[model samples]
Target: MTETPQVTGRHRELLDQVLDKWSLHVLDRLCEGPLRFNGLRRAIPVVTQKSLTAALRRLERNGMVERVVVSTRPVAVEYRITPLGKTLQDLIDALLLWTADNLPDVERARARFDDASAVAGGE
Candidate 1:
């Protein structure tokens, strides 16, 4: 049996910031290549502008993504995954594959839990 290492507050904070819903989507999109603000919005249609902006700022602060100024004429900007962010690719791919493989089992577990909860209470 492998013991889990201690997760400090800083580690938890970083995970919360980087692994949030919008952050994950933003990171995945940026991984492909550089994209302008509008381009990112279009790529993630469900995210509001405010949410996307916040996610980008958090990613930039974490050094996982970079914002570049492309033009002064139209005030263009683009976001791209930094080398640091690229390091997450293999981990993310493995996680996604794991989820795909285990989703059916997860669904069964959830169904059992839900049935138990319903029998216990309305919640």
Candidate 2:
């Protein structure tokens, strides 16, 4: 049997960082190959420039992403997933599968909750 590790405040903070809104998107896209700033932004259309920048910075700080600068007439910067980041691909895939499998149930649950909230508000 596998043992569960103790969870600490620091662990929660790092978990929050790793699983935030844009982190997975950034990491998953980088998994395909290295992409320049504009390319990454284009891949994730809903993300604002500021949000993507911040997510990239956080991932870089966490040692999960690498930033490389290409020197040309006009310099370019690219981001790639590190070895550590690639390790999470399985987890990401699992999460994607789970969402696909359970989407209908989740939608039903959400509709039920919304209906309950509306009924309560009316009462």
Q: Which candidate achieves the best lDDT against the true structure?
A: 2
**What tens digits encode model 2's per-residue C-alpha lDDT throughout 16-103?**
8888999989988998999998999999999999999999999999989999998976988989999999998899888889989999
- Model 2 scores worst on lDDT over the 10 consecutive residues at 69-78
Compute each candidate's TM-score over C-alphas: 0.88, 0.91
Model 2 residue 100 lDDT score: 97
RMSD of 1: 2.6
lDDT of each: 0.92, 0.93
- Candidate 2, residue 123: CA error in Å? 3.6
C-alpha RMSD for every candidate: 2.6, 1.4
User: Candidate 2's C-alpha lDDT?
Assistant: 0.93
Where does model 1 exceed 4 Å of error?
1-5
lDDT of 1: 0.92
Those runs of model 2 whose alpha carbons end farther than 4 Å from true positions after fitting are none
Pairs that clash in candidate 2? none
